[model samples]
Target: MTAVMAPSSSADDMPRPRLLERIGIPRALAWGFLGVLVFMVGDGVESGYLSPYLLEEGVSKERIALLFSVYGATASVAAWFSGALSDLWGPRRVMMLGLALWVVFQTVFLVFALPTVDFPLLLLGYGLRGFGYPLFAYGFLIWVTAVTPRRRLGSAVGWFWFAFTGGLPTLGSLLAGLAVPRAGAYATLWLALGLVVTGGAIALLLVREPTGRARLAPAGERPVATLLGSLAIIWRRPRVGTGALVRAINTTPQFGFLVFLPVFFTDTLGFALSEWLQLLSAMFATNIFFNLIFGVVGDRFGWQRTIAWFGGVGCAVTTLLLYYGTTAAGDNYALAMVLVSLFGATLAGYVPLSALLPSLAPDHKGQALSALNLGAGASTFLGPALVGLLLGPLGVRGVMWTFAVLYLASAVMTVFLRLPDSAATAAHPATDHPATGAPATDHPAA
Candidate 1:
């Protein structure tokens, strides 16, 4: 479908002011996305090997899991407020805060926790770091939403996730694979810490303060509502609420399934570590391509329809096939790799929901975007928690099937997504409200 770019300003209209106009939109967004990527890469460097390292250092498996759970929980709360804070303080200020916290907490972890392997310090340090990337990366996301035109929102959000996923767990894990063997885990961690600080500083310096039409709300009109109330208000919106659920389940496979995938591949299917890593690389490589492709597809087909058919249903089918290929097909690595890639590609459909949420609540883009991120943070904890709990009783096969069903359920939930009247009519004015052959009358002022 043809994308309608931002509304053009006529010569009679005042020219909208811009931040970093010298470099223009492309350069500004590139620097912003790169900043997010570097931070995520730093976060992800530990994804594949962190648990094992803890175990090697004499930390119990249960304690390691507990650390993740705590980090996720902390991140969920941080994710919610981060958006609202961005709206209040402006993205530039909020992002700087997040980056500062990242550096401080990471430094603590490297010094106190890494050397002694102290669990308490690790808990505090890592939990604080959890607040870092969400605020930093998602702060940029809010900046993007504010700046991007309504019609091209899908493309912008898609690219955001492209840089996001491209770094984390995918590229990060790849880096860790190399670094862990050569540099050792502590050194790799130090490297990641250095990168995060450097990336955050550079991105902040490059991005000018947003002004003009790019600003989300009036300078003095910040909402006075409680954070919980703000979140509740966004959740009450039909499209935004449904989008949240869709977002939560959309990443279940990544957080949940991937938790068990490597173990199953190496232990059950008898694949080598490098081979499983290769499979993961292939999946993310395909995901990077499809994320952009489906953004255009959503612009063409409608975002809701793309979510239902492509993301929800497609994830269900591919997940089931991938699981089956792993268990029933018995060591068919070739088939398994194809199914994994298909799963990754299908997931691209949900990327548009990021754009859709902000579009639904233009007036409160921060709250809507926060709701979107809350779903992501919730999935991080809940997906793995559920998998951990179910793995014992249901077995790996059973866990995969359950997540596939959840994907289907999330897709079905999309039926309830009704765009707000304003957004619905903006792009298609004729259908939502029509004029009658009566004299124009103004209602009494409310």
Candidate 2:
């Protein structure tokens, strides 16, 4: 199919803005990036040590696994809805609702559940709080895609993931490493609550992007229809569903790794909790950097090729290396760090899929994004569920192998996510809009 190109001046002839454009930050949504980074850091403060912390609080490993699985399930649902709701209610409104849910439920989890070690309360509160970040974060993502020129969408989304992951596991782990030792885990949790609120306030108040404040869908589109369309698009565009599956496999192991890797590194391998947190931070620090690198690479090298080979195949190889190589490294922290860093970098290889997926159904961008977000949320659930189920029978090595196999499968599935030849050509930088220098409005699939 021939993609339609919007008429515009050449981007090359247009005067480029300063550092933000150079660094791949969409100038229109800069505040949103800062907001997501801080907000996610608050959310992710517990990621490095939360499982072990629960065990110390008298929660069984089985229950901890269950808690995370439930949390993931809720997150998945919320992630899907974030897109659909964005279409109906506007991104800003959806973000507000998400922030409110997070604050209220998080307070319940901390004040009522954690203090008493009430398992039921813990599940209810934390699981429900899972709705918060995706709405706030992915809602902003829709905003980014709407305003960013098509030629730069990959880089813009890359910056989004860079901020999102950077805050969550990177700086978040680093913050935890310092805070847990100083203030204790419970107090550190309270600190996270404060950070989240502060970040949310900044984004809502400071960001002035007009598109996010109004519905992206047509004016007459009914809310129910928008919601239903989000689901129906999966079948109407089968490639989108395939892309969702690939997106799910992209991060299944990352979430699973959090469930067990801490214990493995600390208990089995003789590392301190702080050391492990440091390792986690270092690993994702590498990831945030490569998020930018791969964003640019995908724009130049072809998004599908980048995702298939670098994201899917490279991750498959690195997932195995991260497990076996680290094991073989014994007490060699330096070597282990290198292996883990490589794994983290490969994870960023899938960043382009965020740009690629929505382009598949531009006329239904919100619905298309819902499919992508569904996969994202499912991975959170699937990863931990896999660990909870397989860790008993298959053990860590077997679980690692399972993830590797899934990555390989994702690489193969990416073969089916091809774009039309003309659409692909339109997306190339050289053929971008002559006036604004933006790429064609009708984006290629995959």
Candidate 3:
């Protein structure tokens, strides 16, 4: 759940620039961004590095896929509860618990579990990984929203996600690769543990504990019922999956698919896994570089429209390519991977949506983002399951086509979405919303 801006004291009593113009962004955001590092380390060490290690250790591909699924499946349940718990006990406490769990998982992976362990037992232990994800993710989300001025909320949230997803698979890839190749998988676990412990320590020092009723009670924003209810209303509309919500879910498909992509390329495209990984890594490296580059573009242009346009166009081209490019003479492995990266990049939309939801539901940012997380988490799990099921029936071509259909649908729905009448949209045209300033008539004026 995204918690962009925690409710704060009125300007008359508070020391800051009325909350809106405050200046602690660097200090406050450092903690929030660190949250990304913690989560990514946990994910990277386990998902990024461990899967390959386990494969080397003799786990079957099907089992590995199930292992991956278990992580998301467990996280889906854990995060649902984390939302209510974060709302109740405060995200800080919940987050610390998650980090503590991370310590357990990393330590357990190294000292106790052996290659002789039964596959089922290993899966159960891997499922424990989910318990850590929600708490840290929520911590980062809330912390980012709490500190960022509304004006910069879009860029800030985008940057937050940039670190969270990009950290593990991209930046940390080198470390994981180096550790495993040099010292073995067990050593990699120890090193990842070190990075996370450092991050967790930072979390404790940097992030303030969310206090009793952080939301403004007098303004009627603090009610737990409102938080839950707003989410209920949004989901009931039948349109949320089409909105920024879909883009969030889309992040996982590209990622989850990549975990199995070697199997796809080798089995379907007739390349060795080594050759496929080389191609895949090159593509992923490109994807990671473009995230920073395009992120700047989003800041300069409108985050919302850029996300829509890029995702839509990217989805369209990728869909056509997947349908026929793999069939043609060139095949263009690099091009295919670039589109895959684009499929992933469109996810930058979540940032503006993160900031925008709070602007849309000024009183209920946490709830909205919680609902958003639920959809995203659900899609992450569903994507792999769908792939597993469909790959046998539809075959590899069918699976690619399915992604095409889903993304194209995403593009169509994007056109009709109305921005919640927000100060962000109204205050600036080119600076705020490049393509979708959406004429003054569509959304209610803030």
TM-score, each model?
Answer: 0.85, 0.94, 0.77
- State the RMSD for candidate 3: 5.9
Candidate 1's TM-score reads 0.85
Best prediction by lDDT: 2
* Model 3 Cα lDDT, one tens digit per residue, 1-446: 33233333331134434332332233434565665666575466544445556777888767766766777786665555455555655656666777887678655545555456567667656667667766667655655555444545555565666667665555466555556667876776677777777777777666553431243222434546644654573554434434435644455556456556655555566765445444444444555545554555655666556656675556556555644665563346666666545544554433444544444443445555565566556665666676767767887677777776676666566554445545445423433221122223224312
- Prediction RMSDs, each to the true structure: 6.2, 3.0, 5.9
Q: Could you tell which candidate, 2 or 3, scores higher by lDDT?
A: 2
**CA lDDT of 178 in candidate 2?**
98
Cα RMSD for candidate 2?
A: 3.0
lDDT of 2 by residue, 342-442 (tens): 99999999998988887676556678889999999898899999999999999889999999999999989988777677556655555545432345454
Per-candidate local distance difference test: 0.70, 0.85, 0.55
Candidate 1's C-alpha runs over 4 A off are 1-27, 212-217, 221-226, 329-333, 420-422, 425-446
lDDT of 3 at 228: 63
List ranges where model 3 is wrong by over 4 Å. 1-26, 46-58, 106-114, 208-231, 236-245, 266-304, 319-351, 420-446
| Model 1 agreement with the true structure over 124-222: per-residue lDDT tens digits | 998777787777887787777655544455776778888788877678878877887789889999989877877786678765533212334345554
Between the candidate structures 1 and 2, which one is better when assessed by lDDT? 2
Model 2 TM-score? 0.94
Consecutive 10-residue window with the lowest summed lDDT within model 1: 437-446
